[model samples]
Target: MRALLRHALTEQGFAVEQADDGVSALEWLEGNDVDVVITDINMPRLDGFGLIERLRAGGRHRDRPILVLTTESSDEKKARARSAGATGWIVKPFDAEKLSAAVRRVAH
Candidate 1:
């Protein structure tokens, strides 16, 4: 999934970085700043919800746009993510154009 997203975004002229899990993503964010973030709901070390919460709690990335790309499609989860400060959501098996458009919209 990461590979696909990176490829698609790269093709659209956006530089992309990927992490294996939420822990790695947070570690990368500690030293790097990005215009947007795309994460999955389920991962090891820390789930996406926890990641979003941690990012929201921090001063630096509180307003950073995080786009959730997951298979889960529960309204409850969506509400939780919204409460945690996610900028947008996209279900898996996504369209490349839609993903790119969402990224562009949120990044702006």
Candidate 2:
């Protein structure tokens, strides 16, 4: 999924960075800046909701866009993520064009 997103986003002229999981994502963000964040709900070390909460708690990432992309579609989970500060949600399997468009919309 990371490779696919990287290819698609890079093809659309967006610089793409990836992490193995929430832990890695947080580590990467500690030293870099990005316009958008797309995370899956089932990641290891820290799930999407946890990741979103941590990001929201940080001043540097609080106002950034975060889009949840995952197969989990339960309303309970959706509400949980929203409360955790996710800007949007996308269910898999995703379309490259639509995902790219979403990234474009929130990148600014």
Candidate 3:
């Protein structure tokens, strides 16, 4: 899924970086300047909710848009994500077009 999203982003003329888990994502943020973040809820080593919390607490990405891409579609989960500071949500099984659109919406 990550590879596919990376490819799509690159194809659209955006430079892309890959992180396998939330831990590495946070670590990467320490040394990188990212325009936006798109994460899944069920990731290993921290999960998307925890990542959002950490990012918000760090103060660097507090106002940066975060787009949550996950299979969890319950309203409760969506509310929780929004409370955790997610700017948008895209359910899984999405196509390349949808991915690009979501990225453009949040990253811009």
Candidate 4:
């Protein structure tokens, strides 16, 4: 999934970064400046919700846009993500065009 997303986003002319888990993702962010972030809900170590919450609590990436891309599609999960400060949500098996558009919209 990560590889697919990376390929799709890269084809859209965006430089993509990937991490296998939320812990590693957070670690990468510590030394990088990114325009936006797209994450899944069920990552190992921390999970997307926890990552968003942690980023929100931190000073650096608080306003950074985070989009959740996962197979999990439920009203409850969406609301939870919103409350945790996710900028947007996209279900898995995503459309490349829509994904690119969402990234473009939030990256600003």
Clashes of each: 0, 0, 0, 0
- Ranked by lDDT, the better of candidates 1 and 2 is 2
Better of 2 and 3 by lDDT: 2
Q: Indicate the residue-level lDDT of 34 in model 2.
A: 91
What TM-score goes with each of the models?
Answer: 0.96, 0.96, 0.92, 0.97
Cα error of candidate 2 at position 39, Å = 0.5
The CA lDDT of each predicted structure is: 0.92, 0.93, 0.87, 0.93
Go through the candidates in order and give the C-alpha RMSD of each one to the true structure.
0.8, 0.8, 1.1, 0.7
* Model 4's TM-score against the true structure: 0.97
Q: 1-108 in candidate 3: lDDT tens per residue?
A: 788888888898788888898999999988888888888999999999999988988667777888898999999999999999888998988788778877887787
Give every collision pair in model 3. none
Model 4 stretches with alpha carbons more than 4 Å out: none
What ranges in model 2 sit over 4 Å off?
Answer: none
- Candidate 2 has an lDDT of 0.93
lDDT of 4 by residue, 1-108 (tens): 778888998999999988988999999998998999898999889999999999999867989999999999999999999999999999989999999999999897
**Candidate 1: clashing pairs of residues:** none
**lDDT tens per residue, model 2, 1-108:** 788888988998998889999999999998888999999999999999999999999768889999999999999999999999999999999899999999999987
> Pick by TM-score: which candidate is best?
4
